[model samples]
Target chain A: MKREIPLFLTAVIGAIVLAGFFVPHPYVSVPADYLQRCAVIVVAFGYALGGANLVQVNLEGILRRHPDWPYKLVLLAGMGVTLVFGLFVDRAKFQDPGTVSLWIYDHVYVPMNSTMFALLALFIASAAFRAFRVRSAEAALLAVSALVVMIGRVPLGDAVMAGVFDHPGLPEWMRHLRLEPLQQWIMDWPQNAAKRAILIGAAMGVMATGLRVILGIERSYLGGSD
Target chain B: MTISTDFGVWIAALLTLCVFSFLYKDNPLYKFAEHLFVGVSAGYYIALNYWTVVDQYLVIPLRAAFDGSQAGGPFQAQMQDYRGWLIVPAVLGVLLFTRLFTRLSWMSRWSLAVVMGVFAGLKTTGFAQGDLVAQVQASLVPLWIPGDLWGSLNAILFTVGLVTSLLFFFYSREHKGVLGGVSRVGVWFLMISFGAGYGYTVMSRISLLIGRFQFLLVDWLHVR
Candidate 1:
């Protein structure tokens, strides 16, 4: 009964929402809109549930004096402080610029997030240098293309092209062969075509997966052994 | 060379350095910063959603429905009218907490089922109309432009590349002869595209690094 009820609900709800797109009547559309809003509310609860889980797990870790308990303490402290400030002091305008919550976000959160992504710059450079060796025809083509695009998209490459093209005796053909123009051409034709192809295939895959889920053929999300 | 007087800028710089310290080695500073980031962000999101979704949508409406106050907003009016129906979702949301209890965990499946079903339905039509139909329409390019050889060549190349790439993904038959050659060409196009993508990604990451450097130098240190 448990399994059957959930599956039936999934099929029925899925069908009704999908039908809402085609059926513009107030009866269908209004309910569909309400369902979507309800989904958002449920999702918000899910996030709060996740936050609760984090606190629970970390508090347990700290109490048990597990390895790296100090970090857990820090995490719990940060969450507690932010939650207090946000829920009480700045509840009405927590998002306002001068609020304590906003202050923490702008200073601590923004820097941490940006720095984390910025680290990718150094890692990518090191990784590309190590991995971009030309071992075969395909690898060679890839390396050359990457190198060309990398250089062509940057100002240094444009400066070099400008210097060469603006020489006193430079030909018209040489002027037309600038890095930026070549990069644009490559992006416009070959890159765009490949991207479109991938997008189309991905869209097909999404449709198939959505159908499977709606039909309850994909029940992995239901959790438990099954 | 003079540091700024702003304490917040100093805090930001120190935290940025703490995160960047991971590049040198895993240390307590990085660990502290990482944990703090996750916890604070979670709290922020929880607060944001409480105000935006729970308090605004659910709590306020339920309150208005109970008090019979017409002073509340538009959503409150709707909820007051359908207050009975609104109880269903509130119950479903409360059921999600049943996951914490072992025996009652199965009840949470109803909530998950509704969420997944609604999302799957929305996404199916969204992808079909927006991505599938739209993309296919875009691929129908006029290959024979009257005056522009460059445009015509580009069109032809684009069409050929798109077809070959699609064929490459087609695993129905054995790619042994003509299909093999075409698929190989498709792979070349894909590789080139991926390379460009990687290059673009690298450029953006570098730009982010530059932004951080600018923050440190200009904002914190008052460097020109």
Candidate 2:
């Protein structure tokens, strides 16, 4: 019953919601809506479960004197401080400016988030030199496309083009030689088509997967137990 | 000549520097900031979820239902009626914690099953309606525009790209001769898409990096 019950629950719930889309009756719609709400509540519990697991894992690591235990200690301390400020305080204080939560958010989280993403710029440049090498026609196309986009979409590209080529002495085509229009054409036609094709294929894939799950054929989510 | 007087600015500046120090090498400062980030993020989200979902959806509805303390006039009757049904989900939500115990872990599957089922069902119809149908519908543009050569060419190119790209994903049939060539064109289009995407990403990230530098120099150091 342990396994059967949940599997039955899956099939039943999935059928109800899927039916609601076609049937549009209150019996299906109402139950589907209720199931969705339950899912939200359940998901919130899942988040709390995740947070607890993180705390537990970190605590265990520190207890065992694992590698970077001090960092783990610092991690727990940050969580504790943030939680105390977020949860133990009054609602007004928690949400208001100058609060400890807000202070940490502003000073710590914002800076870290910004800097972390900003570091990606450096990493991407390093990666481009490594990954964007041209050894074949395909590779060359990719590299050229990237270069065109990099130059076309940015201000620096305009300045470089205008400085070097944008002269009255140059031929009309050469004078009007701009990366932006070429980039735009590439984006509007092929890029957009690729995106739409992927979307359509993925939608079909999702439907198939959903059906598989509802049929209980995809039991990967259930784990190996019973 | 002047450093900022605000302690928050000092903290933000130092943290930003600590993160930037990563460009040199992964060091203690970056590790510290990274760990702190994960922990603080968890706590922040947990608290936010408590306020937004748990409190708003489950707790408040259940609390008011039990306590009989809702301001009632027109919508009160409907509000009070459905509030009682929330107990079912509240019980299910509690079931998710059973996984923390080995013996009780299997029970958590009950809650997970519901979550999986609802999402799968919703997404099945959602993707079909929102993505597949919508995209295919939008792709059906006029291929031959009179007196608009470029427009016609663009439309035709779009149709060919879309068809060929979809064919590239068709694995049931062997790709040979004509199919092989078409799929090869699809591959090129996909490569262009990826290249453009990467280029766009690099530029945005660089812009953000510039913003960080401006903050350090112009905002903090007064040296800009």
Candidate 3:
């Protein structure tokens, strides 16, 4: 009953929503709209369930004196404090600049998030130096293209290009050899064509997978092998 | 140079430094900041949805349905009508919590099934209309243009590139002779595009680093 009922529900609900697109009648549209709202509400609950799970896992870690027990305690305390402020405090006032919840978000969360990403800058620079070596034809092409694009996108590259073009006795055609224009040409033609092809392929794949799920041919999301 | 006087800014600056310290070496300070970030974000989202989804959409509608009272704000007019149909979703949302209990875990599947089903159906039509049809239409470009040599050349190149790239993915027949040569051209196009993507990504990461430096130098420490 458990497995069969859910599978049946999936097929029925999927068909109704799919029919609404083609039928466009109030009978189909209204039920589809209602089902969508239900889906949103259920998804929200799932997120809350995830938050609860986080608390449970960390609390267990703290209780067991795990390797990072101190950090777990800190995590739980942070969650507990934030939850209390968010729940008990007036909802309308919770978002005010002076509120504790807002303070934590702006001062703590924002900085931490930005700094984490900022660290990636250093890592990427080091990685690119090692990875962008030009040993073969494909590698040379990739490296040269990357170098041009990188230089062309930045103000420094524009300045360098302008300086070169300003040299005395330079040919008229050499004056037109600007990095930005070349970058634009590369992006607009070959890059755009390749991206479109990839998009079309991906769209086909999505439609196929969606059909499979709706028809019950794909049941991995149902959580067990059937 | 002057440091920020605001107590909150100081706390923020310290936390930012604590996270950045991981670049040098992982330590207790970095670990604390990481854990705290996760905890706070989870808690914030929980509160956000509790008010936005549950209270605003589910509870208010149910209350107005029972009492026939006008709920203020954007939903006021809808509240006046009082939808009895909303009860179904409310019940299903509650069923989602059943997963926490082992005995009732299977019941939660019903809620997940509905969500997945509706999304699958919607996505099928969405991809078909928006992506598949639109892209195919876009790919049907003119191969030749009158009185514009460069334009015609570009058009032909675009057409050739698109066809060859698509052929590269077709696995029904072995790629050899003319097919192999065309596929080789497709590989070069793909490589160039990927290289551009990688460059763009690096630029963005660097911009993020510049933003942090500006914050630290301009906002936290007064520097000209």
- DockQ (CA atoms), all models: 0.66, 0.69, 0.60
Model 3, span A163-188: residue lDDT tens: 88868789865764678777777788
Ranking by lDDT: 1, 2, 3
lDDT of candidate 1 over B1-224, digit per residue (tens): 89999999999999999998999999999999999999888888889888998787777766766665554533442412544355667888888888877798899899988898888889999999999999999999999999998899999999988999888999998887999999998888888888888888888888899999999999999999
User: In candidate 3 chain B, what residue range of length 10 has the lowest lDDT sum?
Assistant: B73-82
The residue pairs that clash in candidate 2, if any, are: none
In the range B104-144, model 3's lDDT, one tens digit per residue, is 87888899899988998889899999999999998898887
Which lDDT value does model 1 have at A147?
76
lDDT values of the candidates? Answer: 0.85, 0.84, 0.81
Model 1 CA deviation exceeding 4 Å by range: A165-173, B70-84
Against the native chain B, what TM-score does each candidate's chain B reach? 0.90, 0.91, 0.85
For DockQ, candidate 1 versus 2, the one ahead is 2
Clashes, model 3: 0
lDDT tens per residue, model 1, A2-53: 7778888888888888988999887777777778777877888887888878
Expressed between 0 and 1, the share of native interface contacts present in candidate 1 is: 0.69
A-chain TM-score, model 1: 0.92
